[model samples]
Target chain A: MTTHDLEYDNPNAIEAHNMSVYYGSFRAVKDVSLAIEKNRITALIGPSGCGKSTVLRSFNRMNDLVPSARVEGQVLFHGENIYAPGVDPVNVRRRIGMVFQKPNPFPKSIYENVIYGPRINGWKLSRREMDELVERSLRGAALWDEVKDKLNQNGLSLSGGQQQRLCIARALAVEPEVILMDEPCSALDPISTLKIEELMFELRQHYTIIIVTHNMQQASRASDYTAFFLMDSDRTGQLVEYGSTSQIFQNPKDERTEQYISGQFG
Target chain B: MAVTELRRQPSLLRAAFERFIQVLLVFAAAISILTTAGIVFSLVFETIAFFSEVSIVEFLTETEWTPLFSIKKYGIWPLVTATVLTSAIAMMVAVPLGLIAAIFLSEFASDNIRRTVKPLLEILAGIPTVVYGYFALTTITPFLKNFIPTLSIFNSLSAGLVMGVMLIPFVASLSEDALSAVPNSLREAAYGLGSTRFEVAVRVITPAAISGIVASIVLAFSRAIGETMIVAIAAGQNPRLTFDPTVPVMTMTSYIVQVSLGDTPYGSLSYYTLYAVGFTLFIFTFILNIFSYWMVRKFREVYD
Candidate 1:
């Protein structure tokens, strides 16, 4: 299958060209082609184990960490193929950052966690520069006011909601062009989830945000674009429908998407 | 009615059986505690008897340890110094190599490679310490003699090096387990932030697993301190105050081995020295293990 180049009114920030992600012989996501536009929140919504996370992980080539996992098609970032020969996964990831399902702050201080990305990538900032960056990133994630007094405290010391926000701050510190979130709010409480949803809306002004979520309401509530995925007969996940959130919610083209969103079937 | 009663409560017979099982388990747990207590009791009285014959101040302050020699010096320093020198050498050899092996096993190796290689590393641990003693005496001693300027035939250097080889599995296996235990999410987060494999493994993964790795190394060092065969064979039984690894020096274990091998009269002063040395060895290792426990507690990142 080839990538479907639809008449997208918005220019593409990233294009997944018939990407079939596999683990050894088993295909997890089969021939998934998606175009995520710049400055927009695109939600990959589906039932559990539908390979939405796999599709999201492929954006940063995180699936490369799994020895058996392989990607068969091109994932183009700003028109450059990420999986092409000689392309650095580190460089690809620097351009496109990710937030995991659970809040995974590094086992370090809050200040250190925010600056970890820049530090590893050889950004030799002065003490003042580091302090400012830490503040800016924390503020960017909407956690600075709550945690400014305790920047030296361990990242894991934060509440679950705060930890998730800290992870967002850590990802934001690198100044990534695209942010991929895999169920970033799945482990958060309702208030925290709402806060994160608000942060996503604000973040859409700067980053091309792609989020994988099992929550139907999160997709309908937060994302501008919603892509519904369903398991095929063979159990490999495939894209069922893609459209504006309002259209997908009100008038889903596929019956499966309607069934899934209406809680009729999963 | 019987089914409903059974669901509501366990039968008296079954309850009594469960209590019997719990008592059996508790008795099993108490056996090790009793053994430890017994060993301590045996060591304490003999140690007290040895100390009564030789003053504690003289045992500590004096630099020489030649109670069996014509001169009859009785300093613990000679044996203590030898133990320190050899154990330090063992740590030097084991720490870097073992940690690197752990890092390789945990972070770099493919799953197939890990499955085969991890057991091979454990095989190093499985090899008897007596075999290590022979390897130290014959192979390491001769090999060092060829290269080192002042390396001796029966020296602590060979014993320490070979003992370190024996201990590599302990450090590597535990550390690898620790590194692997660090949730995949942590690694993913590091990678997602553009960390290279080296960066992720060292800077991120290592920090997260430092307590476990440090505990492994410390336990390996303690094992090195207590090791008998390699030190006894390769490191000679001659007690010397010199700190040099190339010289023949008697460790506490080796001295005890030398005495136990010879038929010294029962309850003699020489026989009493074995208990005294054993007590010292016990104290040192006990302190070391306790310190390790404290350090592990101090450094634990508490990821969960």
Candidate 2:
């Protein structure tokens, strides 16, 4: 892949054009168009049900799980249309990893949970290689030092913070290009949330990340770019502003964004 | 201040009513326990009285079981063996079918399909066992006779087969509950990792709920062992130790029914045989119930 082929001028990892999501007859996200940069943390901050999480799920087609949900227009990843016919949703999901709001570890040992993604994808690594990968992934999530001696223990035996880190490691084990985190620190204490924010800074060097959060300070602290979404008069979510975090918080282009950051309204 | 002074006195009648309700609730719970204890105590005492006259060795070792004949040979093995054989066959049939149905309902069925199928399954459980006995005698026996020419009109094979069908809903309903109780997040986590739906169900959900599944199987086994009307009506009351389902074999339950219906002389060996058989059946089912309860209690749910 040459520099020209990769196109660093517009190094957009994800490009959404006129994408709208509907559940039954009610539209949740209306004509949202945004370009997420590669190798940067983009924070999606909005009030609850503002379609931030909905847009995050749309990236990996996770919304397909909802029986009544439907998506229109285009979502492109690496210049390829993810929702095109003949494109496998499973393959799309494998390339784009996700960590839910709550930590969800399988009812298995820590070792098993970390290796689950690679093992399912038929990555035939030797036992030693598998162990090294597990350790590497755990270290990448900033959890290896805490759980090095208890790899054989059940994943559920860990504290809430440790479990969330384990889930991050699980997502990392697959070697995905992009990671989507839906309020990954919402359930954690302030100290653990700080730790996760630091981990996210470290992770941005290798993988493009999109995080949905309600905490404005977290978005300002950890993200390079921020997208502000707001509910319209009709109760549907619409993007208000998208720019560098410094610009969005310090000098917002939209008045709605200013009011939102100034705590006048959601 | 004046209104508060007037309301300061608590109503004695209201307090007494609350106390009365609490006492009644406690009394109801105690009655449940007392009823179980009474039945167990009566069964034990009567069983002891029966065992005094008949040697334990004779009851256990003898193969021929003819309590009413002029030359009585009282051996419980033939009846016990019959019960085991039929239950084993019934379990072999029920476990696989029930588990598959449960997996389908819990994992694969659409919401609409499940709504229709689950109640239809429970209807099978709701059917009276006597109706199953009649169905076995009339339909299943004749059906089996077409394949196996040697099948007796009243044989353990047909009875056990129909009994297995009757037990299907019991196993399926409980196993479905176990499978449904497995958190949706677990399945989503597996899917997010690129696991196929089958892989998630087989690898994650099944193992997560293994204890509950095992408990359901054990409970179904107990139901099969304790079933009476199906075997009594379809399986002839002749206690003979034979593996061939073509021949008439008597179960412990069937023998109890036979002896009770015949009006055997009071205080005679035949009269005492009922208690002996009842005791053995009780012990067998009690052990199974305990094992099932233990397996369910031992299960640990994973939540993060």
Q: What is the alpha-carbon lDDT for the whole of candidate 1? A: 0.91
lDDT values, one for every candidate = 0.91, 0.90
Looking at candidate 2 chain B, the ten consecutive residues that score lowest on lDDT are B295-304
Q: Where does model 2 sit among the CAPRI classes?
A: medium
Q: What does DockQ come to for candidate 1?
A: 0.84
lDDT of 1 by residue, A1-266 (tens): 22324323438888999999999999999988889988999999988888888999999899999889999989988677899999999999998999989999999999999999999989999999999999999998999999999999999999999999999999999999899999999999999999999999888989999999989999999999999988888889998899999999999989888999999976
> How many collisions per candidate?
0, 0
Candidate 2 TM-score over all chains jointly: 0.94
lDDT tens per residue, model 1, B1-304: 9988777977799999999999999999999999999999999999999999999998898888876667776788899989988898888888999999999999999898999999999988999899999999988888898888688888999998888888888999999999999998999999999999999999999999999999998899899889998899899988989988898999999998988998888888878888988999999999999989998999898766
* Model 1: per-residue Cα lDDT at residue B230: 87
